[model samples]
Target: MSSIGTGYDLGLFFSPDGRLFQAEYAYKAVENGSTCIGIKCQDGVILALEKIVISKLLKPRANPRIGSVGRHIGIATTGFIPDGKHIVKRARDEANSWRDNYGSAVPGPVMADRLGNYVQLFTCYSSVRPFGVMSFVAAYDDLGPHLYMIEPNGVYWGYNGISAGKGRQIARNELEKLDFSTLKMKDAVKEAARIIYATHDEEHNKEHEIEMTWVGEETNGIHTAVPDDLLQEAEAYARRTVEGGEDEDVPMNE
Candidate 1:
């Protein structure tokens, strides 16, 4: 039976279709945000993002769409940036807690599952609004580099490569053409950057603004920004492809 609510606007009460209106709204928000890409490759994983700062006064952030959760685990996000941050912070906490308790880092799928639980708790009550965010997490472990996408409603999926946010369909379509089964670490990063440049609108399509990394053996992967020099190289390749320019060094792979 449909229960009566306080009759407020845009509340997250369950409807007959087994859907939460507020959660659907949050998904819509993600659909309209900047694009983020994550790919699981033979050697490791890579992430790429579109950078568009409205104010010229604001300095650029390398990983605006990405955040490190632990040594080996990282998350790429899109939608309301703050909500993404919140999810990132929680992922870090969970990772740290695992290390402290079991003396081991949490695996990628486990971390995603735990975070999904946290997100679902809020939906139990109408007082808290669902976060207007979605995350694509890249993690490495015994399974090697793993890619997973989680929605605001606690749904998660594993993928070889995935894209989210504004123009994501286009980006994903482009990404599907690449052979992730054979993609190496270096090439994966470059291809990710190309996808961002190829798909993002002119405003956010800035070269070298993307963040990337790979998972390695041992505990978790290092939670640091991908080196600037290599990132610059990838960005340059992307710029050439996006603008349809041809230089000896630029690869017109798009």
Candidate 2:
């Protein structure tokens, strides 16, 4: 059944088999996937995550891993890592397409919206299978900061802010305390760092560092990884809250 849609383009229609947005892959045992937190701001979006990768036997990988896209969209993924990488690639591809179609100089907000729309379509393609990848997509939208929580099922929810992985519950709880609607950009970053740090401490985990990405008017499509010094400061702050800090002093910037 095809229905005409008015407003923008009427040349698009959805098909089940044409695009299956489902995760049909086996889950491999891995040590760490990703720990991420996002903050929605008036100017832009802030996202942070710790990368922990494990070998086939569930042992931590020797080299640290950091997943980024187009230097603008920062994706900290959880769940199926390989799938996460695939998702990142998919996002990058969409970003490139938007650049090619609209112009090489697409705005950050436009890029974020394009990514979100792509994720939705991907989900539709997957149908009702199992999706192994889930990620926190934080970027700037025309209205300001745009945050989205993307699941493997292709179901994405626009959010003021979101966090993923082991420490998400702790981060979410902490985010509730802050007035996100009126919070400043700097405050949002610090809060995200604080919650992630607290989340690691509450779990008695050894991983201490949190990765971050920010998109704003100045930054445009250029996403900068958090500096090492700043992550150390955030870790110190998170440590004070709980007794005996055991979180590793890994550099947040990878």
Tell me how far the alpha carbon of residue 182 in candidate 2 is from the true structure, in angstroms, after superposition.
2.5
Q: What is the lDDT of candidate 2?
A: 0.57
> Which lDDT tens digits does candidate 2 get at residues 23-123?
32211111134557777777667777765322354443223233566655666667766666766777788777777787754454554565556545543
Which residue runs of candidate 1 sit more than 4 Å off their true CA positions?
1-9, 62-65, 203-208, 217-220, 247-254
Candidate 1 structure quality by residue, lDDT tens digits, 5-94: 544336767676466777877899998877888888886787777766666666666335677886788887888889989999989999
* C-alpha RMSD by candidate, in order: 3.9, 9.2
Cα-based lDDT at residue 25, candidate 2:
28
Q: Lowest-lDDT window of 10 residues in candidate 2? A: 21-30
